[model samples]
Target chain A: MNITSDMIYGYTDGMILCCLSEQDSYGYAINNFILEKSGFKYELKEATLYTTFRRLEKQGHVTSYWGNESSGPRRRYYSITQEGRAYLKQRIREWKEIRQLMDAFFIDKKEEETET
Target chain B: MNMEEKIILYINRAFAGSPAAEKTEEAKEALCADLLEKYRGLIEKGHSPEAAYQATISGIGDIFELVDSVTGENREKALPSSSKILPAAESFQKWGPAAVCGIFFLLWLIRFYLAPGLLFASGLPTFLLGAVLGALGMRAFLHRNRLSFAPLLPKEQRPYQLVWGGCGLLFLAALFSRRLNPALWLIPAGAVALHQVISAWIAFSASRKEEDFHE
Candidate 1:
């Protein structure tokens, strides 16, 4: 609830891709990973999740294949692409840079507090 | 359709009837297997079947938004060099082969009638064969691994099946005209057009749906 929606949407695809890079996964598995990792703090709607899958696939960040299940229809399993790995690396750098920038600005408040 | 069923329907709509045999089935099987497993787990955890399915679906997300963002959706684009300027290049992208074949077909009709047996050794059916083979070859080209424009084309190319397929049937009818009367050929032609037009309309309508991916 405290997190800005923008921040969540922006990073979701990258997070999903990074998760998929570890191994191929389907939509639900990916969602669960996000939930478990965030300690149930962050969850994406199914619509948002598939859109990220589509976006990543479109961007050459991931590829999906179908596998037969014991019951019901086949599942579409997605995996990270080489380009996706490179993209995740870039996003990681950008996220770190943003974190450091925010930390610097927020900590600067302490310096000004003493001066005042 | 129920939530789970709806998901299956969409996946089939996307990957079924692809140019290659294995490609569509492969896509369908993978999506179905994982989605169903997830659905099963939710049901086991004390959720109503429908609610569980809904929750699972709500978590998966919108495909068009994904496709649009994936390929970077653009404003209406016209097929190049056409003063007639048919709207919807994205739409045309699907039927590209048919439209191309249509032009060639019309040309061939003229040639076959005006210059009957011009390529006397191979005959008209040979040209038709060439068209079918050409379409097949192009399908092979389009679906080839390390596909030239993989990311852009995969999601976008699916809608074209009806178009290419229509042209193919038309070409086949024309090829086998001697075996079957010219009148019988129109059945397939009408069927082809009906299918492509309807499919094109559906795909185009879906294209207009809200991408719904915030930020």
Candidate 2:
């Protein structure tokens, strides 16, 4: 049986919050960040990305505004709010705990026991 | 059409049945811009225009569902009351006045049949009177419901209250002045029109101010 871990495929909100934590970005730019961060293995559908944006804004975790670019079409940029940062921090802590739990459950426990 | 235009056309077609509103337009514009950017990026990566267009279009999942979810969220937020009460309230709002108008018409019909001379001697068309009264009642009902139901933002509360208050004063003045000249009834009508214009203006300016702040 072929087993693979694809935990990063979901967590669209957390990925977006992480992206915005560094700097504010627009739809395409944030998706680009996700694309690159995921080693080009995952890309969000436009619908999913924008819906997450709306959801995050509604949750007061992010705020959006129009970009005042002089040379191109106006883009709506999102920035993480203070609440978003705190939410992201909590998510990261949860992710670390989950990661540890998964490694403990899925790794070669027999080999570790023999080694000890 | 150019690639940008093609993307715009696709977006327009996707959102065709959605209600035309400011937020919908914003969503459409954002989608178009993002799709075009992605398409250009694909082209830059040596993908042919057709392939890029196909890929770009494919990346947008079920746009109708997205729009529905977004608008549905707004609908939910705009009405915090129970969902069961909405359809009942809406039907009443739509048909209650209409039913009253019908009843008034029926009464007029009976009076006409029984006392045709007296009906004509009243010097006013009873049907028109009933219709006007019914319409006024419906308007007032709708106005009241709209104000009550629409959870206004803190920024808009003041202007909304002021406009409604001013309109009420104008309405009362018009009613009192009707004793002076019957034509003064037009004052209330003018007040209604003025109220709408002022409300629309306030809404427009508020949106403009938000845009400026964002920019």
Candidate 3:
């Protein structure tokens, strides 16, 4: 089976935090950014995206406002707060450590065993 | 129908039967706008309208979680409103009367087995004790259910209340049993058994009501 969305839901907040850290953007733009960044290999469910937006806003990690669009739908735009940036940095550092540990434990061990 | 109208129809179906609220309405609007933008993006890439609509609808995943977050309805359902009663106090309120009732019955058992004809050996006090505990238990049970906004113990529960009240009076009669045969210890014991039966009935009915609520 394919890797389901739930498997990576934990990283969604971090992804959104990173996306918003670049600049203030609306729902579609942020989702599009994630889609393009993943080389169209993945896209978020709209429900998950908005749910993360609400949760992040609740946690003081992001703030949202209605964009003043004269025509069509007025989009709700979100920006990373200073707190969100700090949180994102912390998560990145933790993830890097975890990644290196996993590589040493699994990848390096497996390569060594195969060689021996 | 046009793309926008098709999307709206799909959204309506998705949110069908959800409670109408300001927050939910806002979420619906935001979701509609986001999906519309996505559908258009898909369309621009040369997908047919039907394919775009199918893709857009499927990409929505489960929308109820979003609804639950925005409305906070699920949170309220999952937890008792802390503002109304502290968790520790609420738990105490729920179990205190039953515990007291159990203790009184336990004391009566010890009295009957360990010491016959001891102080207050007629077991009249036992009946009165059961009556008072029965009343207290009823009040506490009703209060706990009320905290969760359960419908007032409906007409069906009336029979249980009446039976419980009858248990109280039986114990009240035990208060006078000292003037008669002491073998009437059997009366207090019977009333205690009836009290347990009534409590079990109430508990069973309460659990049934909760099942109905979940359904």
Best by DockQ: 3
Per-residue C-alpha lDDT of model 3 across residues B104-179, encoded as one tens digit per residue? 6667667655774674645556555545666565666556555532334445556656666675566556556666
State each model's C-alpha RMSD to the native: 13.1, 14.0, 10.5
Query: How high is the TM-score of chain A in model 1?
Result: 0.87
- The sequence of per-residue lDDT tens digits that candidate 2 reaches over residues B60-141 is 9768767886667656665634333557767677557656766776676667557666655432355446447666665655
What DockQ, between 0 and 1, does each candidate earn? 0.35, 0.37, 0.62
Residue A42's lDDT within candidate 2 is 78
* iRMSD, model 3, in Å: 1.1
Instruction: Report fnat for all candidates as fractions from 0 to 1.
Output: 0.77, 0.55, 0.73
After TM-score superposition, the amount by which residue A52's alpha carbon in candidate 2 deviates from its true location, in angstroms, is 0.2
The segments of candidate 2 whose C-alpha lies over 4 angstroms from its true place after superposition are: A1-10, A109-116, B74-215
Which stretches of model 1 miss by more than 4 angstroms?
A: A1-5, A68-71, A107-116, B1-35, B60-215
Winner on lDDT (1 vs 2): 2
**Chain B TM-score, structure 2:** 0.45
> Candidate 3's residue-wise lDDT over A1-116, tens digit each?
34468777689999989889889998888889988887777788888998999889889999988788787666888989999999999999989998898897899889989999
Candidate 1, residue B121: how far the Cα is off, in Å:
49
- Candidate 2's error at A11, in angstroms? 1.0
